[model samples]
Target: MRDCCLLFQGGTQLPSSCLRDEDVVALFEGRLPVSVNVLAHHHAARCAACRTLLVTLAHGDALPSDSVPLALLPLEQGRRCSRRPSVPDATWTPPAVLDGFRLERLLGRGGMGAVYLAQDARGDRRVALKVCVALQPDERALASFATEARAIARIQHPNVVTMERVGEVDGRPYLVYEYVDGKSLAELRPPLPWPRVLDIAVGLAAGLRAAHQCGVLHRDLKPGNAILEPDGTVKLIDFGLATFVGSGGTAPRGVREVVGTPRYMAPEIRMGESATARSDLYALGLLVFELCTGRLPPVRRGACAAFKPEAGRGPAALLTEWLPGIDPGFAAVIACCLAEDPSERFAQADVLCAVLEHVRRLVAFQRTSRVFPTPWMGAGFPPPKDEGILAGHNVF
Candidate 1:
């Protein structure tokens, strides 16, 4: 091992430990740790994957014009790497079938894999199948799929997407989940009516409760991960980033990585702390705020740490400020979820679920009695300069 004290050594030797995907990302974003910054550059110079990764990341950044998509380049290497630019290839078609499921079409894709809507002929049902199609799947990517399969396999809930099967297709791990026949919460145009928002929030809480009861904590709980059926049934999907609840639980895939979606991550998680059920609730609070206002909470440096919620100064007050004439009781519910302090947030998912249900009933009753507090409040939050932040997706 090299000496940690070599503050500015012009090191030429490669570190025995290879740089991870996160390390590469941090290095590109200028967030890499100083101790290994030199080693990362040296390793990237020698490693084909890392060099290609830098190019891809650069293409995604300011130097995008420099990128020559794999499709445009050539088919010399058929491997799909996350670092590659995503260029539309009209010629590319879905494989007819994989294992037994008939691939209908591509639903979505990520750095490591693609999810397809498929037909489960034997079961006479439809399923969403996630297949790891990475050209040369890395250990972390494979471990993610395996961990997701195991995590979802252990929990069964109406609100949470149900897993049908787990197996490998051509050496790549694939997971089959019961299809929701609908779009994600994100797909449903934001600033949905307040009542509808409450319904989705309640369903999400129930799904989270189920996961928590099974000792699973969804480290990432953004709207995109929550699918809504035609009838508005919220089905929480994507357990790839989930972990067993509690401090003593084993790390995900036995690898501890703080690679959560920054916008949805709780303050503690952002500062490199273990995730908890409360952290998931914090994300829920952000989702609810977006649903109500069609925008996310501002992304300020050390936001949560700075905003210590006092009695009247909690998240509710801000919600009321942004959305005039909103129900105070309902605003308070979301405020509790957004509390900067974990201890101040809901102690359990079940508790939050019950509180939301109560609010829903009260709103319905008030509406029937013609005493509703607000007229389906969704009037505030002007469009942000960057539309990406429109749907409450302010990344830190």
Candidate 2:
């Protein structure tokens, strides 16, 4: 212990009595005395082992080459002592006015940006102001941001949030969208009534259909991206990951990386394949399943055939077991949307919407007839038949 202390004190009597690990750590952390620091530096310059130890202690790993001098390396004291500009807290005062809009309170925030509830002075309407605050925007992120604006601008639907305009404030790209005075579906307490869930599902599908008609694909669709109005109207929001397809527009530029909420992503998307309209339908199916059962279905592995039952039952049987009380017709629609093979799923969003609308009408009719028997059915009316609900329609 005495020898170790002496070595840390920079005694030059015994050059081989090198500094201890504690001393090395202290020196790296700038905790060593000034005199000892100078002596330690001089000793480290001459000793190969001491130099390697100092480099390791400072950087947590050995450098590739020892040819670099110790003085040139970044030290703890140098980094701490250097003055750096303070980053302003944007939420503190926020801006009084940005691009002619009066900034109000923050709505939400994500990895790439923050959304604020703002009032458009010119239009006298409230709008959601989304600003990209990334210090350095990568090619993919920039392309996606621009793509979102273009995607929303091309589609006009009651069930989809509308973008008013886009502009830059202080070099940050910001988008203004029609503000939705409602909560996200994710905020809803679980076990929402099936009727209300069906309503939301119908609206979401309609919005997706509209987007699809415009040759747009919402790559990321989930409960969190859906806003539910007081009147049970669901409006789909956030097209940051949307891409265009077919003749209406070009595919998302520079979007090579897989982009979507993983849990809601389709099997093909999870496997790094390009997202199609069917992929969006798959995500919508997951969203509907969550709204119905307040939970996600069991993960499907490998191929769709794996989910097939030994008795030759369809995949819908699997979901029926997990979500009791769910209408068999509705469950079957969801299962078809979640088909591992895109070809097995609804070919278009409009077709899925039509099927869902029919199911909703049947469910409503059954509920009404069960409570109050119609005159045509005497005292009791049998529940509506599901035989013709999907008949004569090319769903697959």
Q: Give Cα-based local distance difference scores for all models.
A: 0.66, 0.65
Per-model TM-score on C-alpha atoms: 0.70, 0.68
lDDT of 1: 0.66
Q: What's the distance in Å from true for residue 195, model 1? A: 1.3
Tens-digit per-residue lDDT, 188-271, candidate 2: 986676667778888999999999999988887987788999888889888887877986233443433345665576766544
Name the 10 consecutive residues with the lowest summed lDDT in model 2.
62-71
True lDDT of residue 230, candidate 2: 89
Separate clash counts for every candidate: 3, 0
After superposing candidate 1 on the true structure, give the runs of residues whose Cα lies further than 4 Å from its correct spot: 1-94, 246-256, 303-313, 371-396
Best by TM-score: 1
